[model samples]
Target: MKRLIPLLLLAAVPALAAPVAAPHVAARSFEQLAKPLPLPYAEGADADAAVAAAKARARQAHKLLLIDLGGNWCLDCRLLAGTIELPDLNGWVKRHYEVVTVDVGRFDKNGQIPAHYGITGRLAGVPAVLVVDPRTDRLVNKGHETALSDARSLTPQALADWLARWV
Candidate 1:
């Protein structure tokens, strides 16, 4: 059993180490991304409202929290959001930090967001998950792309790892 454990991990490493859809997204051009992207959640709530509440919660919480710097209009953002909110992944996430999401489109014009974090000119991609310190507004972690776009490819697990950096 012990000897086979190495083999088991070896077998799993390739599957887990890289994303399945990375190549497709990495190869895509800006024109490909110009279309509508899907997201896990609705643009149901206001971005500032959501962030305000999450930041308020983080004020009292002692864990390292994440501020997802993306929006519901993005594919990579949606994929990452769905993964983190999954039962098992959320279990791990809740253990380490609080979470909030910022809408790149709406928040960019505000002074609260840095110019570098702006999703302008080029395609910002929906799910550029940026981990930040809610208390201090310092950036801690971020992920760029997923299989949805050609310029960047990201998988759920790969996205989770990036969010893990914030946690």
Candidate 2:
């Protein structure tokens, strides 16, 4: 038993020492940020259609559209949204991309889109961005790939740059 303990401890060392990189941040030029991303999406209240577009785009070009899913009263959603609507970012977003704000009942008293979209977690705390490709409706990214789902770190400009890279 004592001999085995030494081997087991050695094996665990690698797992504990893995490098931890800080969350990714994009630093693109302001001028580039202002330009339209050149990807277009069809719009309606139909989330299925939206997901379908995601699938199609994913298959064809490996692109994902940013989906801000939240109710009106979620504070983080509020912060993320308020940041996006700031004049500089807002103007850029208005010209360069398609934004769909889904009311998933976090802030709203009785919204149904959250269930329709198969969401199973916090509705308001979610700055839940579904980067879905339109060609095949595949999901490319959801805010973060961390150990805990509580790791979404996106600024409107940083998010805009991330989306641009895929498109």
Candidate 3:
């Protein structure tokens, strides 16, 4: 009876834990992604204004603010941007986040964006994703900002999974 009680308690543990949501991805592989991945960064646009607008929208919509800091020249940044725009993932992202892209040209421009979230010094790389909570205006994923810096190495589903984690 004692052994059976322990087994029953062990079984209950799984039920008590939170369930992880599966990533929504349309593409099965990276090769299947659309040709000439999108150049999302707008060097000519005002990044500060864009971020402020996004934050306001996020607060009003009760969604998280997703700041995508990268340059058009970075292949990994483009890959990450392309993956996020995938049909299935795009819808999910739109539902949960107000996204803004800031062009950090060769890590020289838009230094204030990351600094606003207390990320000082040299960035790890391009495609630094900042997930901010609209209510508090705090960075949710602090240390993991550069997690997708090497987007080329991740599968489409893996990229979606990474974004889903913040949601």
Candidate 4:
């Protein structure tokens, strides 16, 4: 009977361990931090027109144009988007850069945007960011376009610091 009781308890162990849901942070919006989260990338969108409009807006606003190059399918891209959408950071981005999301679908679509910035090949990874000075259309942070590529590993503070540096 003792051995049978032990075996019964062992058999119930899996049932006893219930799955736990992650605790939600109060400040994060539903759209900002949802699972398979909502990102701001437009698939098959025209990068040229987007850039041109952003350039005009940046020129008028006297701000840099921040081109977020990635697809909606990328988790890192979505993470970066969510990080930037944080209330404080969102205001900073609006003040300093005219943000544009250029969707590079599986490294297939929207290759021209980066090419326009003189990068001939496909990017090192998704969420390749390009901060361009509207006045000269220069790539301000040339090699660091993939700074946010490792969004999964970066802390919110690190991302904020990176954004602040360019501003």
Candidate 5:
């Protein structure tokens, strides 16, 4: 009976463990996403000021800073923007992050933004998402900066999952 009780307790341990919840994602496929995807990067806006403001907001809100370094001309960047703006995902993002989009025109402009995170030289690709810890002003997801650079090839849910991983 003692041995049986121990086995029963071990079996119950699995059930007692809390399940990790998957991130909320509304779009299952690319076609389900909104048409004429949003151009999130503002070419004329001051990228430095925007990042500063976002960092401030993130610090105050106790949220992470999500710096989206990309260009309006990039299709993948647009795709990532549109997926993030999905009604459900947008709300989730707002709850967890302060987002700032900086236009890196042909990877020529906004070089300093990525450099600020210790990512020198040319970037891997557009939509280099710098997940920052606003409290410390440090990049959280360092090596994975360009993980979503090929957003076009991934499903919206996959993108949402990637964003959620930082949180």
Candidate 6:
């Protein structure tokens, strides 16, 4: 029984030692990838009212409203924010969408914002993005809620391309 115990343990070692798969992050140049920073989701504010204000601005600007739904604790969410803030893309984003970061605190805060856009709660994960046409009060990208949730896996160029597609 002692010999059998050693063999059993040895057999289990490989399973335990197997490497976990790393998250898929697309390659990017240092200049292309913005440095990660703290998420800038406003705390204790009515998300709906904020979106409404953004919608009004979008209407006047003849642009779309981008409602970014996520929280400060979400790494992917922060990554997306940084990627979008890159100088080249940041200007493009400003020209195209009135961006608003709605903090869904650990999925406990402002969940209704997604529901308002027909996303229920979340699409795939935190950092769900919705592009809304202020002119029509309609969701432009309905099924692509999780498009930017994997910002770590996407290069800055890829993120820019995605944003450009909507415009």
Question: Compared to the true structure, candidate 3 yields what TM-score?
Answer: 0.86
Local accuracy by lDDT, each model = 0.51, 0.45, 0.88, 0.79, 0.87, 0.76
Candidate 3, lDDT over the whole model: 0.88
TM-scores of the candidates are: 0.53, 0.44, 0.86, 0.78, 0.86, 0.77
lDDT of 4 by residue, 15-65 (tens): 254433222233333344545565789976788999899999999998989
lDDT of 3 by residue, 51-75 (tens): 9999999999988899999999998
146: Cα error in model 2, Å? 10
lDDT of 5 by residue, 1-167 (tens): 98899888877864354433436686788778788888898888999999999999999998999999999898889998888888878888888889999999988998999999999999999889999999889998989999988888899888988887778
Backbone clash total for model 5 is 0
Candidate 2: regions farther than 4 A off: 1-64, 107-124, 143-167
Clashing pairs in 5: none
On lDDT, the candidate that comes out on top is 3
Candidate 1: clashing residue pairs, number: 9
| Model 6 agreement with the true structure over 96-164: per-residue lDDT tens digits | 789988988778888888887677744568788888888878887788878888777767777777776
Candidate 3: C-alpha RMSD to true structure equals 5.8
User: Of models 4 and 6, which has the larger TM-score?
Assistant: 4
Q: Which tens-of-lDDT digit does each residue in 1-167 have in candidate 2?
A: 99999888877864344433222333333232333321222223565555446445444543335566654444445545554554555555543334565555534322343443454444435546655444434444533411111223545455445434433
**For candidate 6, what is the total of clashing residue pairs?**
2
CA RMSD, predictions in order: 10.4, 10.7, 5.8, 18.4, 6.5, 16.5
Look at candidate 3 and give me any clashing residue pairs: none
Model 1 local distance difference test score: 0.51
- The TM-score between candidate 5 and the true structure equals 0.86
Positional deviation of residue 5's Cα in model 6 after best superposition, in angstroms: 83
Per-residue lDDT for 82 in model 4?
A: 79
lDDT of 1 by residue, 1-167 (tens): 99999888987854255432211122122233323443544354565666667767776775555555565655556555555555546676776667766565544433253334443443444444444566666555433422233213654455445545434
